[model samples]
Target: MNALFKALSHPVRRSIIDMLRKGPMASGDIAAAFDMSWPTITGHLNALKEAGLVSPERDGASIRYRLEISAVEEALAFLLQMTGAGRKDPGDEP
Candidate 1:
């Protein structure tokens, strides 16, 4: 989707997604991993959330962000289609 591509256009947002790949993490923890201010990191997180790439859930007192793998898979499939990487040849046998 357009939103997903836009969100992934930023390196900071991409890093955030990579971090989330291991598992859900608190916003504070994610922010700490970056050199930028908390507010700046929050902006990236917001972009990712808007794109449906990440989801936030209240974990006790803090909010934890979890990666939505389906979004990433959708993007991967799109790219593969563009490159004809996974498509079967018309003449190929089953």
Candidate 2:
């Protein structure tokens, strides 16, 4: 989980995740969205991949990244548990 948070710590990485929300995208297209050098964007993608927030599949000559919804759901579930947002009502207990 620490890795997930660490990967999300960077704005660039968050943006990349947001981009993937629409659908899988080529690595080159992702890099085109940012002004930084290719290596920098690649590093961010690697971090996201390490965190299990994204998956990369070879698409012919390029790689396409897809968002891993399960990882995001896990993070959201953790936050919900911490905040008691979805807890069952004690008064309703049998």
TM-score of each: 0.96, 0.96
Ten-residue region with minimum lDDT total, candidate 1: 34-43
Best model number under lDDT = 2
| Residue 94 error, candidate 1, Å | 1.1
Measured by TM-score, how close is model 1 to the native structure?
0.96
Q: For model 1, what is the alpha-carbon lDDT of residue 2?
A: 100
Candidate 2 backbone collisions, by pair:
none
Off by over 4 Å in 2: none
Candidate 1 Cα misplacement greater than 4 A, ranges: none
Best by TM-score: 1
Per-residue lDDT for 1-94 in model 1, tens only? 9999999999999999999999999999999999998889889999999999999999999999999999999999999999999899999899
